[model samples]
Target chain A: MKAAIFEHAGKMVVEDVAKPQIQAPDDVLIKVIRTCVCGSDLWSYKEGDHKQAHSMNDGHEALGIIEEVGEGITDLKVGDFVIAPFTHGCGQCAGCKDGFDGTCDNHPAPTNWGGGYQAQYIRFHYANWALIKVPGKPEDYSEEMMKSLLTLADVMATGYHAAFCARVKKGDKVVVIGDGAVGQSAVIAAKMMGASRIVLMSRHEDRQKLALESGATDIVEERGEEGIAKVREILGGPADAALECVGKQAAFEQAVGVLRSGGRLGYVGVPHEDNLNLWELFSHNIQVAGGSASVTTHVKNVLLDAVLKGEINPGRVFTQTYSLDEIDQAYKDMADRKTIKSYVIVD
Target chain B: MKAAIFEHAGKMVVEDVAKPQIQAPDDVLIKVIRTCVCGSDLWSYKEGDHKQAHSMNDGHEALGIIEEVGEGITDLKVGDFVIAPFTHGCGQCAGCKDGFDGTCDNHPAPTNWGGGYQAQYIRFHYANWALIKVPGKPEDYSEEMMKSLLTLADVMATGYHAAFCARVKKGDKVVVIGDGAVGQSAVIAAKMMGASRIVLMSRHEDRQKLALESGATDIVEERGEEGIAKVREILGGPADAALECVGKQAAFEQAVGVLRSGGRLGYVGVPHEDNLNLWELFSHNIQVAGGSASVTTHVKNVLLDAVLKGEINPGRVFTQTYSLDEIDQAYKDMADRKTIKSYVIVD
Candidate 1:
């Protein structure tokens, strides 16, 4: 089977790898239809690499068709188009029952035997609970719809998690830190939740335009304290809620800095720097929340219906697309700041 | 005027100080009827002192009578008894408008010219917004009621702030991670918010008893990892919400550790240690919030009514009392852990 393997920093190669097989009764083999290069992928793409020699492919989001299902699966079957959330849960663990499937006690990410979703064939564990079955086969949706569906697996749902955790509500003034796909998606989510003003921090013109179209009411091209001042100036004060989609230290500071005294912050950026100052949040009466996105929960409960109804076009975040053979270029384009997100059609 | 001054480490002296006068149009002279030794006061009492040769009194909580109202005062009048929240706000700033008067922009605590409330007479600034009227004279209420009213000024309201920030909804399994007056108050607040189970972390029999009486359903005496294990054992899993009242690093870790994957933590302890690890919170999907209590907001909107109706007995937290002359003993006893809280009588 062909899969995109992380060769090293500054390198991603599509090469032959062993085809994945179901090892558990609850598992299913998914033939990938669409996947993408995540902003998080840039972490390994630039500094370190997740894979050593002959290691599995590395990706987390996927939209695919089930090619085979194990006997223990009760609700789903083969040939069904589905959206596979990056983190699969057993659906019965305490974390799962409490609506945090991303942290399922029975199936932590490290225990998964399946290779990454940036592959032609991948085994999805806990298929019965983790996979959200689409309404029809792959031919039922257009390329744009397929892209949106793929995002529901991770990015779009993650964006929604930020807004949801921040408790964004009607008439709220929102500040989104980061202009990546996830940040753009957060602007959409905040708008959907009735935020009166949405400010996107972006210096890039293309990303800024997409964000504005998605729901951002304003934009700040500045960074650091200057950026915070701009947000406050635009809002006439501090914002009600801040969505942190970049994991950098400055992003965290910017997110915390632009909020009002009793404001809330929802951070989705995978923390690469330990820079969150509890003292700041404490003294200012700020509420801080958000971890790994509860992808399956949001996808099944919100994103699916919204996407099906065309209420949101999160797929617009993918400004570039690639074929399986062009996987290296996809990573390069994103790492070089040439694309908002790289959509990969792998079927 | 007589006031309690921090002479040095392990010493408190009640000495003559200049009588306070209304310096601001929004200020009033308060003839303090009751004040108390706060746990926070011990911060200065043990390691350092807050006063030099003739510094103002060292206390924040006060139940008093308005002896003279400023020309700008609108609602309060002379001779009216009131509960003066430790932190006063202008009531019109963005912080106050957002229900966070504790962090009011126009009148941060450093701008306060009034001596501390541990004096016979002190100036209460932002009088119209910060002082909550008691509906009658100080003598109209019993000694116990006065103690409870004094608690409303800071301790009780702070505990309520922990619970409020934790979002302790009905039927929640809660963990109160401190056995002091604030923790006891948090237990009461959690109960009022309809928590099904309240677990208090305490080693002291007296505080444990008080907590149980105040609505704590369980008590974990162990500290650190053992404490978290004990709480999980009692609750059958991690808690839904945790109230960190001690503000120590271990307390924050314990509060965060014993919570379920998506649990909420409300921390009220003045952070003496910068120990909040954002990575831990990020990985666990936990929400952290709380700050200095919004004393004025809580006193007016909830505590006053509850205390007046005899629905709560926060005064029970003050197990010992001392006269103005015995102010030194009050700090000594509390510092030695001889009292849950120390109540001082003045007029």
Candidate 2:
């Protein structure tokens, strides 16, 4: 099996690795069909000096076909197409039952194969619960549809989680910070959730255009207070909800700043700083919510059907694509902000 | 007019002050009938070195009779009994219309008379909206009802806001941190909102008794991790909602600690510290909300009707009473933790 390995900061390699084997009764092995470079992966790629060089798994998102099913897996079988949630859920824990499988207490540990789904073959523990089976094998979907389906594993669902956490509802005015793939996806989510107006904050023209097409009603190129003022100007007042897709401190503050008093903010950028001011949130009465997305729950409940029905085209976020051999370059493009998201065709 | 004056930290006096006159077209004069010493007032009483001596007006809560109506006041008449929310709101503003009158955009400034509702007579600004009519003069109600009505101005409504912000619902397990009057009031609010299990964290015997009587199903006498442990033991898991009625960082953290993954928390304590860690909240998916209570909205809509119907008894939190001349003692008792809440009778 060939997998992308993190050798150190600013360096990665695609090398032959041991194929993952089913170690648990509920486990299943999947051949990776599609994967992508996430914004979060850049955290270690750019400045992970404290991290052990080459000891961590590289990817969490993947669309795959089951090559082998363990004896305990009753609901799925070999050759079935599937989408794997970034964090596998056992489906029976209290967190899973409550539709927050991202915090599933009984979730199986990451595979001991020394790599992740960015590989040719990966093991999925508790396959019966976490894997969302597509109606057919990977070859049945168009290239565009495949890219969209692959996002259900994490990015699209994560974007949807932002809106869900912020309590975005019909006729709302929303401001989405960070025009990366997740933020663009949030624009689509806000539209699906019936936001009356959507504002995407972006400095890049390409990302801004995609966001507008995806349902952003407006765009602000400014940053900080100027950015907040622009959003308010466009919406005629502070927004009803703010989706913080960038984890930087400035983006977090801007999300808080653009919200109306007694407003709501959902953040999913994966915190790079820890300077939250409770006093500001207290005085403004802003409801703050967001975390790792409940990918499995969102996929099984809402997104899978929406994707199959063509209600959303989240695959448009994949502005660049690469072969599995180009995985290292994929990380570089994503890290340099040259690509909104890098899609890798692993098969 | 006799009013409570803050001379300095640990020093307060009852002195004759110039009577407040209608300085704004929207103001109304009220003869104070009942007021209470709040937990927040003690912040200045114990450690207010930076404050100018004798500069700050003391109280914010009052049940009173309208003494004089300003020229602009139309809905309220002179001699009508009313409850004045601590923060007066203009009825027509966006915040008021949205039912968050505490953040009303057009709220009138504090009266210029240099005194507050702890006085014999006080001014009610934004009279048409923020003042809730009691349907009769103060003489029409008994001492018990009067005490309860006074709470609607701030304490009881604030407690309700905690529950409201936390989204407390039927059959939910709730944890309430703080043993003050507002916290006890929160226990009542949790019950009213249909939380099946209410855990009140209080080491104080008097406050615990009052909270238990007010609808707390269990009491956790411990603090920190132990308090959280006890709450889990009582509820069999982390709580579905947490009401942070004390504004200290420890109280805030405990509120966060007791909540289940994806739980909600509402905080109303005037924050004495500012050390909220967004990382913890983000990871656990805890929705943090709350600020100054929308007192006028709660009093006008839900609480007034509930109080009038005898469906709640929030006045039980008033464990001590004093005449207007004993105002300084009222502060001392509340500050010393010798009283749950101190009630002041005025005319």
Name the best candidate (by DockQ). Answer: 1
Error of 2 at A164 (Å): 0.4
| Candidate 1's TM-score | 0.97
Instruction: Write model 1 residue lDDT over B150-222, tens digit each, in one string.
Output: 9998899999999989989999999999888899899999999999999999999999999999899999999
Where is the poorest 10-residue window by lDDT in model 2 chain A? A106-115
The TM-score that candidate 2 achieves is 0.96
Highest TM-score: give the candidate number: 1
True contacts kept of 1: 0.62
Q: Write the per-residue lDDT of candidate 1 for residues A262-318, one digit (tens) a residue.
A: 789999898878756767877788889988787878888888999999999999888
Model 2 docking category:
medium
True-contact fraction per candidate equals: 0.62, 0.49
Model 1 CAPRI quality:
medium
TM-score of chain A of each: 0.96, 0.95
Q: Candidate 2 on A1-347: residue-level lDDT in tens?
A: 88888888888788888888999888999988898888878788889836678754458889888999999999998989899777666788555676766655454342111137788988887788888999976777899999899889888998998999998999999999988888988998999999999999999999989988889989899999999888888888788899999998999999999886678899988887877887777766778888778888888889999999999999988989999889878988988888889999986
